[model samples]
Target: MKIKLEKILNLDDGEYRFHFETAARDIGLGLTDYEGHEVFDRPVVTDVVLNKTSHIYYVKLYAASDARFLCDRCLEDARHTITGEFQVAYTDLKSNREVYDSESEVRLIEIHKANEITLDKDVCDTLMLEIPTKVLCKEDCKGLCVQCGANLNEALCEHAVMQMNANN
Candidate 1:
């Protein structure tokens, strides 16, 4: 979303809150999981807290969405609430001093000429990063039987029983 900085720029140093709700696709989040299953079709809710301290602006972003996907372990349909939170700092320093520090996350913006700030990419990146590498319905998921391709969490397959007996 593009946040207008007109009012914010004119106001004195203070904290401001902004809320936004939009479709996941609008922010370029129309994506699929690792298994090619569609996810996060629901609306994305974002809350921003912008702290204007002098020429520096600190923005805290919180976003959330409901998603449905097949469990990576058991391949069963499951639901998850995907959420992400991050902070970014923007400075309007007029000095020509260069910052060569690679560890600094501060961004420079033209406070006099810029009209608005677009956060679509930031929101997309935050949510994508928050997604679990291994999506699971539960922590201790039994997964599927290798031999019979059966859901081990539901019941033991014949091959699993035979394997267990052999091991014993």
Candidate 2:
């Protein structure tokens, strides 16, 4: 959602509050196109504080989503809860370029308008960071049968092979 901060920019020192619901699909993170189960019952909330003089805006976001992941070990379906937090600065495009801090992780946003800002990209970035690299049903889960391509987690296969005696 786009928030208008024209009023806030007009004042010497002021604060503005905004509350809105933006669709995940609009930001390209919709469950329909995502490679997993749908995300249900969730919305992204953004609370921003804009400083008129500094031309910098501080944004805080909270979001949650439900996702289904394939277990790395058992190959079973696993449900995961994805949540994340982000703090970023939105600066005016006309401001002098500042050197990035090597010691800290800070995302810089170039602001085009003094009173309007879009939170779509920020929300999408936070969700992407929440995705886990590896997903497993359990730590000790048994995988699938390599010979018959059967899932060992459900049942054991009956295929057997004769073993050669090692004793001479």
What would the TM-scores of all predictions be?
Answer: 0.78, 0.59
Error of 2 at 56 (Å): 3.3
Which parts of model 2 have CA positions greater than 4 angstroms off? 7-22, 30-55, 91-115, 159-168
Model 2 worst lDDT run, 10 consecutive residues:
159-168
Identify the candidate with maximal lDDT: 1
lDDT of 2 by residue, 17-45 (tens): 56656656776676532445544335554
Error of 2 at 73 (Å): 3.0
lDDT of 2 at 114: 40
Overall lDDT per candidate, in order of appearance: 0.82, 0.59
